[model samples]
Target: MINQNVTKRPVRIGLQLQPQHMDYATIRRVASKAEELGADILFNWDHFYPLYGEKDGLHFECWTMLAAWAESTSRVEIGALVTCNSYRNPELLADMARTVDHISDGRLILGIGSGWFERDYAEYGYEFGTAGGRLDDLATALPRIESRWGKLNPPPTRKIPVLIGGGGEKKTLRLVAKHADIWHSFADADVLEHKLGVLHGHCETVGRDPAEIEVSVEIGGSTDPKDGDRFRELGASLFTVGVGGPDPDLGPLREWLAWRDATNE
Candidate 1:
C-alpha cells in the first residue's frame, strides 16, 4: 500500500549491534565488521540489562559505547537503536549527543523513543510512569533537547539527525511529524502503510512535507526480503536488523546488505 511516487530516497541498511550478553571487545569487532561490509548505520540499544537470553547477562551502557564507536569507526554513523527518553535530563542528553557527534566528526544519529522497559526503571531507580505519561515526557523533552543544542559551547558538528522510533498513532506519530528526521517502526508492510498515512495526516496539520521524513523499518521478523521490494515501493529507505551474542550471527545482515545495495542501484 506504499506509494513509491511519494519519495525516492536511497536505500540504506542498519545493524543494531545489540549490547546484551556481549563484551565491549566483541561489540567493537562487530561494529567494525558491519561498517566494512557496508552498513550505513550501526546501533546499540539503551538499557541497563539484557532484554533477552540470560537473566543477569553482560551489558554495556549506551552513550558511553556510542562515544567509543565515534572514535573507533571511520565511516558508518552510530547511535543507540533507540535511547530511553526518560533516563537522562534532556539538556544533559543533548550535550552528550553533541560530544558524540564531535567525536565521530558528525557521524552520529540520535535515535530515541518513549521508553517501555519497566524492569530498567525499577532497577535503575527511575519512575515507570504510564505510557501516555512517558510520551508526554518525550513531547516535552524534545524541544528542551533542541534548545540545549543551540546553547552548547560549540554546536554539533552537523545538524544531528534525530531518528524517533515507535508507531503509536496519536502521540507517537504526532511527535514524528513535529520533530523526527527519521521515523522508525517495527511494523509489517500493511501496518507501515497505515501508519505512514497517519504520519502524513499529522504532517498536513503541522504544514511539514510528508516526504521530508525518512521511513525506517526493522527487518527479520514479519519483514522478509520479498517485502523489501514492497517496502521500497512504499518509500521505506532504511532497513535495520538486530544481531547479538558472544559470537554474533550475521547471515541476515549480509542478506539485508545485499538487498540494500541492489535497491540502491
Candidate 2:
C-alpha cells in the first residue's frame, strides 16, 4: 500500500488531444480551450495513421503539432503522449525536444516509449523487430538522447523532464528506475499496485528513490472522476484524460480539473 505522506505531490490534470478524426483547426481550438480550462499538460500521440475510427480519417504528426503548441500556448506543457523511440535518431529527437523546450519557455515533457503498432513500422519502412528487440533499442537510445541534450549549443532550457510510458515489469520498470522523471501507465488500481511494487524493486536494485518518479495514470473517456482517488492512494499524481476529435467534448475534462483542485486543497 502507498503511504499518503510519501505521495505528497500536487495533483495535476492533463489533456491528450488525439490528433485524429479531426481537422487541425479543431485541434488548436480544443487545445486552447483545455489550457483555458486549466489542463496542466497537453499531449498528442505519435503515429502515421489513425489508431481508431475511420481508417483514413484526418490526422496530424506529433512533433510538428507540438512545435505549433509551443508557439501558441502560453502556460501549458506540451508533448507527445509518448513518441515512438524507433521513429527518429535519438540525438536528433533530443535536439528537436530542446528546440521546442526553448520555444515553449521550458514547458516540454519528453514523453517516449518503445515502438509498437506494427503497421507504423511496416508502412514507414522501419523494421518490425520483436518487442524485446524494440525495448532494447529504446534502452540504447535513451542515453544518447540524454548525451545529445548536454551537447546542444544552447542546451535544453532546463533538464527536460523525461516521461516514460510502459508497464513491462522486467525491462520497462528497470529503465524507469534508471531514467524516468515520470512513469505513465493505463493500469487500474489493483494492476497499478502490482506494477508499482515491481517498480520499487527495480528502483531498489538501481539504488534510486522510487518516489522520485511521479506516477501518471491515463484516465479513460468513460472513467469516473472519483476513481482518481484510488489512483491517488497508489501514488499517481498526474492524470491524463484523452479525447479524440472531429469535435471533442470538454465536459469530462472540466470535471477532472475540478477534482484536481479539490484533491489538492
Candidate 3:
C-alpha cells in the first residue's frame, strides 16, 4: 500500500512560469504572487519558442530566467520542469544548477530529462537522434552530472533534489530508479498505478527502494479538489499546475492553493 503518511505535512505546490507572450514584468509579478501565496516551488519550461501560441512569438531562455528567479524570489524553490540534456553539457548544467542552488540558499530543484522537442534541436543545431539514442545520452550524462557536482570548487550548498520527468517504461523509469529523488509524470490514477508498478520493478532491478522517490504530476486547466484527491490516492503528493502566457492566469493557482490547504486539513 502507498504510504499516506509520506505527505502528512501540508501538500506542497509548484507553478510553471512559462514565458510565452507576456513581458518580463508580468512574469515577475506572477512569480512574486506565487511566492507570497506560499507556493513551494516555481518553475519554467526550457523552450526557445512559444510552445502554444504563435510559433515564433515571444519566448525566453530557461537558465537565465531561472537565475533571475533565484534572485527575485526569496522563498519559493526554483527550477525548470526538466532541462534538456541536449541543450547544455551535463557538467555545465550541474554547475549552473549549483550556482542557482546557492542563489536560492539551497532551495533549487534540478528537474532534468532527455531531450524532446525536435524544433529545439533542429533550430539550435543539436542533432535530433532517435528517442532511444537520446535516452542513451541521458544515461551517460547522469553520472557526469553527479561527478561534476562533487568536483566543483564549492559544491552545492545542499544536496539539491534531482527530479527526472518522463514515463518511458524501459530506460527512463530505470534512470528514475537509479538517480531521481522525484519522478514527474502525467499519468492518471490507473495509468500511474501501472507505471508505478513498472517503476517498482525498475527499482528492484536497480536495488533501490521505489518508496524513496516522490511522485509528481502536472495539473493543467482541469485541476480540482477531486483530481487532487485522485492523484493523492495514486501516490502523487506534489501537484504542479502550469500557467502559460500571453498573460499568465493566477485564478487556477489560487484554486489549487485552497485545495492544497483544505486537503491537508
Q: Give me the overall lDDT of model 2.
A: 0.93
Which candidate comes out best when scored by lDDT? Answer: 2
For every candidate structure, what is the RMSD over all alpha carbons to the true structure, in angstroms? 1.4, 0.9, 1.3
Ranking of candidates on TM-score, top first: 2, 1, 3
Clashes of 1: 0
- Candidate 3 local Cα displacement, residue 12, angstroms: 1.3
The ten-residue window of minimal lDDT in model 3 covers 1-10
Q: Write the per-residue lDDT of candidate 1 for residues 95-199, one digit (tens) a residue.
A: 999999999999999999999999999999999989999999999999999999999999998899999999999999999999999999898888888998899
lDDT of 1: 0.90
Model 2 poorest 10 in a row by lDDT: 1-10
Candidate 3 residue spans exceeding 4 A from truth: 1-10
Return the TM-score for candidate 3, rounded to 2 decimals.
0.96
lDDT by residue (1-265, candidate 2, tens digit) is 8956547999999999999998998999999999999999999999988999997889889999999999999999999989999999999999999999999999999999997988889988999889999999999999999999989999998999999999999999999999999999988899999999999999999999888899999986845689898899889999999999787998889999989899988
Q: After superposition, how far is residue 79 of candidate 2 from its true place, in Å?
A: 0.9
Backbone clash tally (model 2):
0
**Residue pairs in collision within model 3:** none
Model 3: residue 249 alpha-carbon error in angstroms: 1.1
